[model samples]
Target: MQFAGWLGMFAASTAVLAGCNGTDAADQSVAASQLAADECPSEGVALQVLGSGGPIAEAARAGTSYLLWIDGEPRLLIDAGAGSFLRFAEAGGNLATLDAILLTHLHADHAGDLAGILNSGGFEGRTDPLPVIGPDAAPRFPGTSEFLERLMSKEGGAFAYNGGYLDGTENKPLLRARDITTADGSGEASVLDISDDFSVTAHPVNHGVVPALGYVIEAGGKSVVITGDQSAASTLFAERLAATRPAILFAHHVINGEQGQPRGLHRTPSEIGELAGVMEPDQLVLTHNMNRSLSRIDDSRAAIGESYSGNISVAADLDCYPF
Candidate 1:
């Protein structure tokens, strides 16, 4: 089925894009129609871009987040970045339908909306414990479980009033935060089975000093990989995922190239192309768009085209890509 209020969604999205991207009403309307046409199908595995931008507070985009739809139900949440709570609502999402929530890292842009989503879900009558998975602790970063405790713990959490999410009290469902230890110097990825139909494997990716993971999600006989803020300094992520030949590869496109941006944080456009060329995914979607990268879209596409010949798409908020 199509989304419940797709027309309203298009109007809101068009207004936001027109204001942020400096596009005219006609251009925004056409873009909105294109996104609407790619809406998730009712009986297949598809991906919905909840928040396609990076950490920046862009008017046209939210922070990085994605919803995996299976049989028309939102089954897996990849991240709940800033503004994703609203995007989820606009996309007609239901918390009761999610199987688990996966956080690639604890970055504010990637996990900022976690509590808000849980608070919203509390009123949705969901009783089963929801799983929140993320990377293990590093020198500066806390583990996934500790992060949740600090945010929702009854004792001294920032949002102690919402402690029911952690302790299963206050008439709210339980929230279980689990840490997945990615590969260290070794190249092996850590695997976790969420259900008979959904499984994920995490590989260590270089994101400055932050503990980050690149996830390869296996669902419904299809494989999809998301590289969260990875840099070209490390090749472990690409090496491990190339064999999977994922149906869709969501590569972060935060910077145009390695000139002004930090090389340890995000990959350059050429690096993204190299990764996509090695993996040979059926579709290569560039997400985590930032102002710098968005401004030079054609140049970035040309650079990526040097190494990859597959279809490359720049994702916008609420865009859907079925696999």
Candidate 2:
């Protein structure tokens, strides 16, 4: 999608921008100083869902992507999915002000627009280096370093023209990639201590060949767990959920039960409810909805409500929440 289209969409939606107060001069100054000092703030975090739809495309929602704004200025982008490049602009998130880009997994529905984001940053004349973090590379999909190498390696790469920036010769934005590794080597995952004010941890989950992950983000005295895409019955997921009590749980409602036939990977509404019940988050925000889940929105909410007493909200594209 074009940047113009995104700006148009943002201009058309008064509701999305209704609650956002433009950052005060002091806040902007703090954000700029933090960027220069490589420091992260410890309060006032906000989360926005850029693409809440699942693998299967939906007109109402895009794929799975989230924008987390910290201290009212610095933005952390998670999972740049197919339409997320446009959605980010539509959300009025400044790509130039982005602090970092974190990917849960290499699934196309999750990290498809990573290159597009880099390209957009270059186009916007951003000269600062941006950090890209994700799991180690596998045969199926490239890891963080390899992914960037393939883009700007200077040897038969897509964005080879920008290699001068990688060498610090030209005044182009540098793209840095960081691969997260697990401790036990059971699978690749890691807990990223972003700063004193915030942290993020990734746990391997069941998603067929995709090497899926779920993230736990902590900031501003609140925490949020985002389950990218996983099998509801996976015990690893339960173990991870048991470790922390998040303020909000953004779970996928894929609904994978059909006449007793087992679905490959992904959760059913009932399974999500059980997990939410175990985690006991303050609120449950269902996201990454497909037709199966969207058609049964009411049923999904009711099923989760049976197991969890907290507030339940079905996420939509560009949904905003204060954390």
Candidate 3:
């Protein structure tokens, strides 16, 4: 059954890539090449790249966001960066069915679309409060409660009138923000069990000037890890994630060189390779790409391949992986 399902998905993907919608053939080719079988599971897990770009907008890439559909429903959304809202709608995902959101950090590139999603839900007549999970914010930014208060506060907030929907007279979706606590000196890393079949754990990583994080998601017996933004050598995070034997690792390529220099926040291509090697995942996916990294994809892959023998791929916008 799994093999048959795999064949069907492959065929469907091929059809989508064959100029079905009058899209540029080159664009379809790029999307098809990035799609991977390992990331897609036949049972019930589906991974969709809503926006695979970086903080800066690119004609080809849309900020940073990933959607995981379980049993054909939006189970989890990881990061809602700059343009992810449009991508989410274009993909036909029902925002009303979203179970929760996991944010890796407070970077504009990663969490910039939160307000947009809230506004969209209001327009769609959704009244239930949506749960948002992220690292603790008081010392950093603002915890979930304060984040919403500032956004929808009636007094000195951005969307003062937006609070009317949450009063129960009309259908207003609530934003339930939950803080994830990290270990002292280790940064806050905690596990969020959304359901019996789905659970996610976060680990703190280095993304200079901000409290950054990475997540390891376990669903349908498959484990997937996403490194939000970190310097290459995160011994603590790597050691914890290594135990999961993730099927796929969505690692960000931000930093380029050593740890403590000016670029102390992001990971270099070689560092990403080392992380993949330690985790030993079935596949390694590099994303959050910038112009410099995108130009050296081959070199990045080669660097990571030296330490990791698993499948390596560079993700693009709207790329789908079935798991």
Candidate 4:
């Protein structure tokens, strides 16, 4: 029921942005009453699912994105699909301290709705530049910088009008893109950000020709690994993830394959089991949900349980995991 209200509020944000009729005072009242701040924690780490669905839309879940909160503040964002921005707001997170934005790849399902952050007046209370990191270019996908240029470059870009936002106009900070080397399945991992508080590492994983990479984010002695649409069967994934020893594995997956579509891009439940069995994370969270996967969650859990004896949870949109 809370998630249902979130979907409505997310829609309300879009309507409010799209010139929907309403008085400012009334909107503020409604927002204040409905979207009040939650009792966020003061320490440890919390993994919040802003979105959890697959390429297609589903009523139960949004797209693929996760928010990493430290000391009750959202500091790192992984992917920003279409519906995630609104979900971010609905989840009681603001962009005030979002320092890093990581992308697994340039697939629309993973990085599509980044415009919400770069929009001139879309958000509030943030003036710091955001560092967007992802894998280098590959056969079909655009590199991180190229991808941002296509989205917000001043000239001849998809969101050209967002130049003002990208340039930090009106005292707002710009959004910067930084491409990191994705270790080519050689058991090597590339460090994207390393600070005294937290560190992030990227490891290359096969997603057909998508130039994909998985991420390991660690802070405060708690860690979580996110596989953004990675192939569970890839040897590189096994090698890279096995090294970090993540506390939780947020792996993408589907229950069954479809006809006339390719299965090389995603992992089957068995494949996920194989990887999870090898990593043996303290907990395993099956994300990137789809209709089939949601319907057969028990079957999927049973299948993965065959290889893994760890705690497993199917993530729903807005689900929170504190560690």
Q: Best by lDDT, which number?
A: 1
lDDT of 1: 0.81
Model 2 regions lying over 4 Å from their true place: 1-43, 164-169, 182-189, 256-262
At residue 313, candidate 4 shows an lDDT of: 80
Candidate 1, residues 35-128, lDDT tens digits: the string is 4535677888888888888888875678999998888888889889998888888777878988888898889889999889888988888888
TM-score of candidate 3 versus the correct structure, residues matched by position: 0.82
lDDT of 2 by residue, 1-323 (tens): 13334434444343234325553444434222211211122357867788887777655566789988676564688898887777776666666777778887777778878777666666676777777777666667677678778777788678788675465446666767787652222354577655566787777676655556678888877899887777764667677567367889999777733221134577677778888888988888988877666666777777677778789887767666677
**Regions more than 4 Å wrong, model 3:** 1-43, 138-140, 164-169, 183-185, 256-262
Q: Give the candidate order by descending lDDT.
A: 1, 4, 3, 2
How accurate locally is residue 284 in candidate 4, as Cα lDDT from 0 to 100?
A: 92
Clashing pairs in 4: none
lDDT per residue as tens, model 3, 1-323: 23323533674587576777777767555544533223334358877777777877765566889888777676788988888887676555555878788887776778788778767877777666677787666466775556667777767668877875335335776666777664321765677767676888878776655666788888878988888877654668887776567888888875443332335677777778788888888888778876666766777777777888889877766666765
Of candidate 2, the 10-residue stretch with the lowest lDDT total is: 31-40
Clashing pairs in 1: none
Better of 2 and 3 by TM-score: 3
Q: Let me know the TM-score candidate 1 reaches against the reference structure.
A: 0.90
Given candidate 1, what's the lDDT at residue 232? 85
Model 1 spans > 4 angstroms off: 1-37, 183-188
